[model samples]
Target: MLLELRDISVNYGKISAIRNISIGVPEGQIVTIIGGNGAGKTTTLRAMSGMLPLQGGEIYFDGKRVDGMAPHKIVAHGIAHVPEGRRIFPDMTVEENLRTGAFLRKDKDKIEADLEDVFNRFPRLRERRRQRAQTMSGGEQQMLAIGRALMSDPRVLLMDEPSMGLAPVIVEEIAVIIEEINQRGLSVVLVEQNAVLALELANYAYVLETGNMALEGPASELHDNEHVRAAYLGL
Candidate 1:
């Protein structure tokens, strides 16, 4: 496994947000966690990126323990998180926001190359490179957020609800970008409430229910599951 969470738990003060959850992401594969709001999907992603401290269990990325590491340090170790909510710096230019993702790196030449690559992947961002991020539409901001994460050149990308608020067309575009990114060999751990899209994109799927692992299997299997169909697919 390239990324593994072993019986990990996260708490908010005295309340546990996630409990003994375990998931794995193999190299070059897209793995997804799907459930309703408050299912601990976002919390799990935060724990993996070191944004939330774990109360128990361990995290290993590329064979090195990373549970206690700082968030920036985790990014340096090749994990980039595109958090929930298009949290781009509103006042900054689109290009500036993208560059900030590489704050921990020192290779100027490679950073520039990565910036160009991001622009190419998101041509809308390139057209608005000099525009403030806040001025862009929701779909454009989502693209900028994803492009920014890719700027870090991470081996594993952790995304939280990349399709939260958008039209169907925009969601389809984001899905294409995600597939393209995975095809380029970056492993992904996606946390999404859109189970239909999640199951379609992921190679493997884990269903979370109020801080616990409810079910898991190959994506195709889950797609055909009765429970998943009733609860998530509206079928």
Candidate 2:
């Protein structure tokens, strides 16, 4: 595995958010965690990105233990997170926001090249490169958020709710972009409430309920699971 969360648990004050949750991401694969709201899906992603401290267990990226590393250091170690709610800087221009993703890097030439690649991947970002992110539509901000994460040149991208609050058309567009990103050799960890879309994009899937992992399997198998269909897919 390129990234592994071994029996990881996270807590909020005294309450456990997730317990003994283990997940693995092999190189160049898309792994998704799907669940209803408040299922600890976001918490699991936060733990992987080092945004939340673990209550127990370890996180290994490329074979190095990194559970206690600072969030920026995690980015430097090749994990970039596009957090829930498309957390772009509202006051910053698109270009500035993208540059922030590479804050830890001294490789100016490579950063510029990665910036160009992001702009090419999402041409709308290039069009609004100088525009404040707050002034853009919800979908555009989401694009900026994703492009900003890609600007970090990470080996793994952690995406949380990329389809939230968008029209079906834009959601589909984001899905295609995710596929393209994965095809280009970046592993992905997707946390989504949209089980159908997630299962379609991921090679493997884990289902979370409350603070525990309920089920897991190959994406195709989970999609056809009776319980998953009844609860998540409304089948």
Candidate 3:
């Protein structure tokens, strides 16, 4: 596995957010976690990105332990997180926001190349390169957020609710970009409330319920399961 969480648990003060949550991301594949609100999907992504400290359990990525590492150090280890909201800098220009993603890297030339690549992938960003991120539409901002995460040249991407608050067309656009990113050899752990889209894009899926693993299987299998269809797909 490129990324593995072994029996992990997280807490907020004394309350448990997730308990014994275990999931794995194989190299170069898309793995998704799907559930309704408060299912611990975002919490799991935060833990994987080292933004939240784990109370119990371990995280391994690329053969090294990363549970207790600082968030910046986790980025240095080639895991980039596009957080739940499109958290681009409001006052910063689109280019500047993208540059921030590469703050840990010293390779100026490669950074430039990656910047151009991001621009190429997201031409709306290129068109609005000098515009402040706060001025863009929600879908555009989501694109910028994903583009910024890519600037880090990560081995894996942890994405939380990428489809949130977007039109269906925009959601499909983001989904295409995700598949393109995965095809380029970046592993992804996706947390999404849109179970239909999640299952469509992911190779494997894990269903979360009230901070626990409820079910898991290959995406195709889960898509056809009665419980999943009724609960999440609204069939």
All candidates' TM-scores? 0.98, 0.98, 0.99
lDDT tens per residue, model 2, 1-235: 9999999999999999999999999999999999998999999999988889999999999999999998978888999999999999999999999999888889999999999999998899999999999999999999999998988889999999999999999999999999999999999999999999999999999999998999999999999999999999989
Q: Residue 164 in model 2: shift from native, Å?
A: 0.7
User: Candidate 1: which stretches are off by over 4 Å?
Assistant: none
lDDT of 3 by residue, 26-71 (tens): 9999999999999899999999988899999999998899999999
Angstrom error at residue 105, model 1: 1.8
Candidates 2 and 3 compared by lDDT, better number: 3
| Candidate 3 local Cα displacement, residue 1, angstroms | 0.4
TM-score of 3: 0.99
What is the Å distance of residue 97 in model 3 from its true position? 0.3
